[model samples]
Structures are given as structure tokens and as C-alpha cells.
Target: MIEANGFSLIGIYGGTFDPVHYGHLRVAEELVEVLQLDHLRFLPAHHPRLRNAPVVASHHRVAMLRQAIHGNVRFSMDERELKRPGETYSVESLRELRQAYGEHETLALCFILGADAFVKLPDWYCWRELFELCHLVVVNRPGHALLSDPSCLPLALRNICQERWAAHADALKKISSGLVYVAPTTLLNISSTRIRTLMASGKSARYLLPERVLDYINMHNFYAGGK
Candidate 1:
């Protein structure tokens, strides 16, 4: 069970983590520092709804995440989604986390998502209810546009847009009544897709991922496409 008192910032960094690269780690680190997060949970997806197929197995993804975040006291891993069967939904994960952490913990649960994912929040399962559960921290990603189109957001979300983007933290806190936030970070060109492609072509994936993670990937013969 999770516990928190006062204003606790817990960041949920959910992803496939195909092989857990540096870009992913960097984003988490930056969010933790910028938001002064109390703790950051790295949730690996067992089955992502948007992805046609996962590039790597859950066990491997989890292991890679562990390796990537090793020695970081502020970071931890949660296999809740991986333990569940079928499609992995953010709403479900947040619900379970809320139950574990209690409702009146004065807690702030922030979801770390890329720009592309942020743009598609309206299509997520029970997306409206998600705002009532936790805040969203949208990170800048290469090749994705800002979420400026109101039509792309649900009615519930659009209603809280002012508070979500308010310049003042208190204003953000007031509207947060279980609201969502959009934190745009520096854009990094790195991506798992590009890493996989490079690995498949017999090229080096160095600098794309953490050294330990890359070793694990090579040891497991991952992304040697057409193998």
C-alpha cells in the first residue's frame, strides 16, 4: 500500500520501455527535479492499446527499466499494469494507485506523457474521469505538435483548460479539483523506433540508451530485426 501526507507529488512515467533508453530516463529526471516530485514510479505497459504490438516482452521491459533507474533513490518501478491482463489503460492504473494512496492524501498524481500521447488523451478510456484522479505532465517530443486545438480535448477537460495552464501555481491548485496539468519539457529527438531501426541495420545504438540497458539489450538479442 502507498501512503502520503500533505502535498505529495508522485509522477507516473508509463511506457513500453522496449529497452529503456536515455531519453526516457532524462525526461523522468527532469520532471522529478522541476516538479520536486516526492517519488516517481516507472510503470511498464503489459499491453498498450495504441500500439499494434509490443516490440519487447513485459519481463524484458521491466528489467530494462530497473536497470535504467538503478541507484536512483527517487525512482521506483511498478508492475501493476504489467501484472494485469489485456489492454493497459492509464485510467485503470490511476484508479488503483489512488486506492493504494488514499483519496485525501493531499497528493498530486502526475502522468508523464509525450506530446503525441497528450494529443490523443480524448480517445483514452474514461479520459474525463482521469482529470478527477490525477494531473498530466505533458513532455515535449520530436515530431509532435502542441495541443492547441480545443476540439482535440474532451468537454470535461476543456472546461478546466484555464486552470490547467494558469500562470500561477495556486490557480492551478484551485482548478485541479482533481485536474490535469500540461508540463512541456525540452524536446529530444531520440526514440525507441529509431534505436530499433539502427540495431536492425547492424548499426550502433550507443548513446541512444543507458550503457547497462544497452548491454542487456544486446545480451538478449533484442531488435535484431528479421531474426
Candidate 2:
């Protein structure tokens, strides 16, 4: 609902968020600062189609996110995706948001994702149409190497890769014109997966997440392997 320079930059950070952690907060902060975003929303997917592992309950995830970003004025939580009944798709969410905000509102929406998700963009539902509604900002993950061999990519994806590497800035500008973009940033090695692993092993996940978030997780007995 906020606007800046006749344009509102709404950054969507969507994930299972089994538990919100420092890596998630760091990326959101970086995107807001670097991209000049007006506001950022932490969206927790209700049913992520691609995830094979069982996710924690949606309500718990949402609560954790709310706690993590409590004092940040620019950050807010949107449970729309988590409330949806079926499979969650970016295109569908974009359409709904556009309707709510109106098309001519001078708003620019961007979805923040890790580099690991970037390579699998082709497999997403209606991914091409998604770009028309919002920009995809792909942040690099620490220690995760990019594919050196482009030959292994699907022909369509390989072509897209060429376009991306050719003119990244131009591609980003063309995001609203139905072209995908890759945004590169400093990668942090922290991840919820690693954090959870540490907690289950009776180790401290101290600096890996916000102190309040860690307290909340401990209180709720989350990721403690049923302890």
C-alpha cells in the first residue's frame, strides 16, 4: 500500500519458512536497500508444489515470521498464499495482487529467491506470465556454484540464459515486459535447513537467527525432533 517516486516496490519473499531465520532477514534487508523497495512482504506458501519434504504447519510458520520482523516498519506479513486452499503458484498470486492494487497504480512487484531456485525457473507453473506481473530477483547462495555447463539446460532455458548474461540490467528493466531477470548479490551460507539440523542435534543456532525468533522456536518446541 506504500508508494515511492510514483512507483511502489513490493518485494515478496515467499517460502515454507518452517522457521524464519537470519538468512531470510538479511536478503530482505539487502533487496529493500539495493533495489529501493518501498515495502516487503514475507509470504509463506500454503502448499508448495515442488517440495517433497513435509512442511511445518502454516500457522506456526506465519507466527514465526511475524515475530522475526516485528520491529521493522518496512516489513509486513501476507497470509494470502498460505490461506489459499490448493497448490501455490506465483502467477496466480501476482494476478490477485494486481487486481487488488489496480494495474495503473505505478507499482512494481518483485519476488526474492535464491540462486538455487533460479535454475529451476522453467519448471514453475506459468513462469513466463509471472514476469509480466512482477520481477524475479535471484540472490546467490554462498558456496552454491553456478552450472558451468549450459549444454545440460533445456533448449528454451539455455536461450533464456544467453539473454540473461548478455544484458542483465536491460533484462531487469524488461521484467514487466515479460522477460525474467537474474539479480546477483553477496551469498550467505545460512539456511533454515542447517539451522534445524543444529537444533535437532542439541547444538546452539545462536547467531544464525534473530534472538527473539530463536526464543519463539524454543518455546514452541519446533525443529527439536519431537523433543
Candidate 3:
């Protein structure tokens, strides 16, 4: 486990893994290394508040995610949001995690997301409280690049992030929460949407994701109808 200054750093990567792909896996792997995360939790959402419901069922998505990260020692899936009823709010999950860990002072929870999602933070339910619950690790997505300037960010989010910006990843290990760090991770062009479209069109999505995950998707015929 990765620890610094007597605090264990855990990474919470949440998304509607729809069907976990290499893009997601690569980012997680890189984040683990770059941030020196002790344990990285992949929290799959039941129904994202800011997005549409996943096309595939929760069970299937969870299964695919399991296969995708099968042998990764530091990676684990957290199914709490999947089991919860109704829309999934990140704040609630972080709150529960903070309580489970006993105190934010002892354990550092770093919530991971892409730059595209970070800009939309203000729209999230109780978004500001998230800073109090965990640090934010922002990575660049395919089209969205990380913007250092606060002016480039959404007004509300930009204002809050100004004081929360961390000079280095190590800063996360020093403080338990309320910091924003822009981490540099491998920029893979692969995306779940592209994979699904390829599968739906009866095209090959090989190498874009793990073979085990692909096999599982084929076995269940999960996105066969362009879902």
C-alpha cells in the first residue's frame, strides 16, 4: 500500500464503465503510478446524474469491468453505487467512503476524472462538498485538455479550484482532501462509445480493450443492437 506522512492514498475512479475499455484501464494504470496510489477503487455508477442511463445492465457492466482489471493487484471494483437504487450521486459515495475510513485526516481519498467531466463539476449534486470529502485528480481526455488557467474553467468551478490547486501530486499525500491536481496520463484515443459503435456495426474492436472483456461482451451480446 502507498502511504506518505502516515496517510494512505486511495484513488476513487467513478464512471458508467458501460463496458470497460483500454482507454479507461490505461488511465487507471497511469494514475496509479503517477499519483502513487495505494489502492484504486473503480466505482461504477448505477445511473449517472449528469448523463444518460447505461445501455448495458449493471450486472453485465460490472462483469466486464471485473474481467478488464482481473490481474491488477492495486485495482478493485466498488459496487456500492451499482447496488444503490435511483440516480447515483458522487458526493454520497465519497461521504460513505470517508466515514468507512474513519477520518479524512488519516486516509487521503483522491477522486479521479477526465478534464471534460471536471469542467461540468458545478452541475453535480453538492459539488462543493466533494472537495471536503476527497481530492480531485484531473486527467486529460481525448478532446479535452487540462487548462491551468482558471479563466478557462467554468465560473463556479474555476473560482473554487483556484485555492484548491496543488503544485504537485505529493501535495495530495500531505493533505487529506480539498486539493486539485492535474495529473499527466497517457492519452489513448480509445473510448467506450467508439468501441460500442464498432461492436454495434459488427466491426472488430480488438486491441481497443482487453481480450477477456471483449470475450465477455461477445458472449453476452451486450451492445449488439447498437445500444
Q: Can you tell me which runs of candidate 1 are displaced by over 4 Å?
A: 1-6, 147-163, 168-177, 225-227
lDDT of 2 by residue, 1-227 (tens): 32333455678888888778888888888778777777998878888777754356888888888889999999999889877788888778878877787875567777787767777778999877765677767677776555556675667767755654423433333234343445555567888888888888888898888788788788888888422
Per-model lDDT: 0.77, 0.73, 0.89
lDDT, candidate 1, 178-205, per-residue tens? 5445565666789999898999998998
The list of candidate 2 runs beyond 4 A from truth reads: 1-7, 146-153, 161-179, 225-227
Clashes of each: 1, 0, 0
* CA shift of 45, model 2, Å: 0.8
Better of 1 and 3 by TM-score: 3
Would you list the clashing residue pairs of candidate 1?
176-179
lDDT of 3: 0.89
Backbone clashes in model 2, listed as residue pairs? none
Question: Which ranges of candidate 3 are over 4 A from the true structure?
Answer: 1-6, 225-227
Worst 10 residues of 1 by lDDT: 167-176
TM-scores of the models, in the order given? 0.87, 0.85, 0.95
- Highest lDDT, which number? 3
